[model samples]
Structures are given as C-alpha cells and as structure tokens.
Target: MARNDVDLLDLSLDELLTTTRTVRKRLDLTRPVPRALITECLEIAVQAPNGSNQQRWNWHVVDEPDLRAEVAEVYRSGMSGHQADPNRATRDIDYSTEEQQRIASSVAYLRDHLHKVPALLIPTVGGRMDEADIFLQASVWGSILPAVWNFMLALRARGLGSAWTTIHLHKEAEMAELLGIDAAKHTQVGLFPIAYTVGTEFGAGARQDLADLIRWNGAG
Candidate 1:
C-alpha cells in the first residue's frame, strides 16, 4: 500500500525509456524549448549517483543566437577529420544500405543545422583529466555520464529529444575559451543539441543481439 500510495506521472516507463531516440533529422529546429523545461530536466539529472557523492556536474546551456552559432561552428569543424575517410559514415554499421544513407543524410543535416537547434547543452565536470590514469579517468567520467543519461531520459519524458555528441569535445579548449569556461579546471564531456522533437513517436533503433552483448559470468 505504501508503494501504491504514490502516484506516478502519466507516462509509459518502458516506452519512455526505450523510445528516447537519439534525434537528428527529426529534431525540431523551429520550435523553441522553454528554458524552464531544461532547468526541470537538469534538476532530475543531479539526482544521479556520482563518485563519493561529489556531485560535480555543471551544465552549460547555450540558447543565445550568437553563442549557439559559435558553438555550432566549432562542432561542425569536428567533421573535417571524418571527411578524409571516405567510408566514415557507412563503415561497419549494422543498418541496411538505405537506412545507412538515411542516417548519413540525417547526420549531415544535423551537422549543418546544429546552430538552429533551440538549445545547446554542454555537460561538464569540475575536474581535469590530463594526468589521470585510465582507471582514474573512468571514475571521473563515470561520475558525470549517469547524470547526462538522466538528463536525456528526463528530456524524453518531456517530449524533447537530443543527440549524444562528442565530436565538439575534440575542440574543447578552444570552445572553452570562446564560452569563457576555465578549460584548465572543467572538462566538457559532451555537446548535445536539444529541442522539442517534431513528433514524439520514437522507437528503438537497430541494435546488436542481446545474447551477443550479454557476458555470462565473465565469458568475454
């Protein structure tokens, strides 16, 4: 009775969790995302677990046109390396030829139009990783990744969508200088373009077999 006493929000938890697609072409560039909604999602995000409960998460939300443009420019610049590799978009992907082309087109579209997305969310941690060993770096990243996932789940629940992007992090220092982030201290983990998706009817994408992915008793 104690568990039943609490009323949950009117949402399908299974559907919400699975259908929170990584939106690219379907991201509604024209729609304006309310700042308040983003704030609410982030409030949910901070509830995630972290190293020693350090709670070192900080979000840099850029909605200003000029700043978004600059961030988008830096983000798009990351594609240059991929340009040199002709098969970068289609290499070893699981999707079919048509699906692969569709994905490639969507990726290109998102890259070109990232500046027009309603909001740019950058998740950061309050520490640097330059000298950290692999295990230490894993701990550092482990602290923030859960919160970022929480943020994305919360956004999905609210009919918003975002892509988990790290290309821009390749230019993290330059971007930090542009955004006045103290690059020496904070590490920007990802660059996510957020918006109310054009339609909320999302579904799971193609993935490898669960049995193939599962490792029973450290079989791997």
Candidate 2:
C-alpha cells in the first residue's frame, strides 16, 4: 500500500502532549478511518517503552460496521445500569461543578453515539492479571499502557481523536465472546473510538496546581 491517505499534522512535542484531549463529542463519527492510518499509528506506537521489551501487546481494530455495532451494544449494556447517574464516578474528583457537568455531558453523548464512530480499538496484553500480585500486575500493565498512549498521541498527530474508555470491560467476558478474544490468555486494556476530529483545534485542559500534588524529594 502507498500509505499516503492522511497527512500528519505539524505539531511540536509540547503541543501534541498537551492538546490530545479525550475526545467524545468532537469525534467525526461520520468519517471513515483508513486501516492503513491506524497501522501507521501502531507502527509508531509499538516503539514505546515496555518491560523487558517483550512486546506482548495486540491491537484489535474493529472497523466493520456490524462488529462495531455489536461492540457498541456491549458498551451500552455495561453502562445501562449507571446511565441514570453518569457522573457517579467523578463525584470525588477535585474538578469544579461546571467542569464535572461538562464531563458528564460529553460522556453521555459518547454513550449514545459510540456506534456511529468509525472504528473501535481494543488493545490487549499477553496475560491475565486478575489474581496476580501487584508486581506482576504492574509489569503486565506497564508493558502495554505506554504503547496505547503512544497510539493515542499518534492519532492526535494525524487529526484523529480518541478517548480511553473501560466501561465495556464491565462486560469483558461478553465482549471477549463477541470478539473471539481468548480471555484466558489476554487482558484487555481499554476501548478507544477512532475517527477524525470535527475540528482540529483544542486547548490544554484545566488541572490542579502541580505544587499541591507534587513532592520534592520524599513524602512531606
């Protein structure tokens, strides 16, 4: 393949780092994301740091409309019990009421429209960590998360956007069957919706003062 379908946006490292928002409402659900572009991002993503360089990650990109619809149904089923209070998970966060409401609205929108997104990515690792010790769990997850984050960054650089979501994992077994994922052997990281952004303009998100969260040398 020629692999020239999309052009990578010219973004400095800092700009790329700060502006890759968790896109939900702004995702261009009507547009199609080429598999080659997803592969291009994965090529850059797998270069991320991992434990012992084992590289035991698998990237499952679902672009087929029927499959995507099935996955979205599973995601919806996972959220059905909680839709009445979508912001329940953020109740303890430090964000202001306005910020919280904004998050809730976006989350609700994604829940409703996830089936419309062009593609869904579910990255998995080699081992089952549900009963593992903290050390093993850390090693397993540490190996895949950076690569996933790298994939997200690469998506942002190419004008696509996604949000890391785990709501579907609540029904992981059902999802595994639907996708034929060997749950006994692999652990899913999260679900990501991939598509071009409605607009390419985004700004840094608000956060708490670093001074309040950072430490100098040791626990103060």
lDDT of 1 by residue, 46-108 (tens): 999999999887899999999999999988777665555666754567666797778778888
lDDT of each: 0.85, 0.90
Instruction: Give residue 114's error in model 2 in angstroms.
Output: 0.7
Clashes of each: 0, 0
| RMSD for each of the candidates | 4.4, 2.5
Error of 2 at 28 (Å): 0.5
* Shift in Å, residue 153, candidate 2: 0.6
Candidate 1 weakest lDDT stretch, 10 residues: 1-10
Best by TM-score: 2
Work out the TM-score per prediction: 0.87, 0.92
Report the poorest 10 consecutive residues by lDDT, candidate 2: 82-91
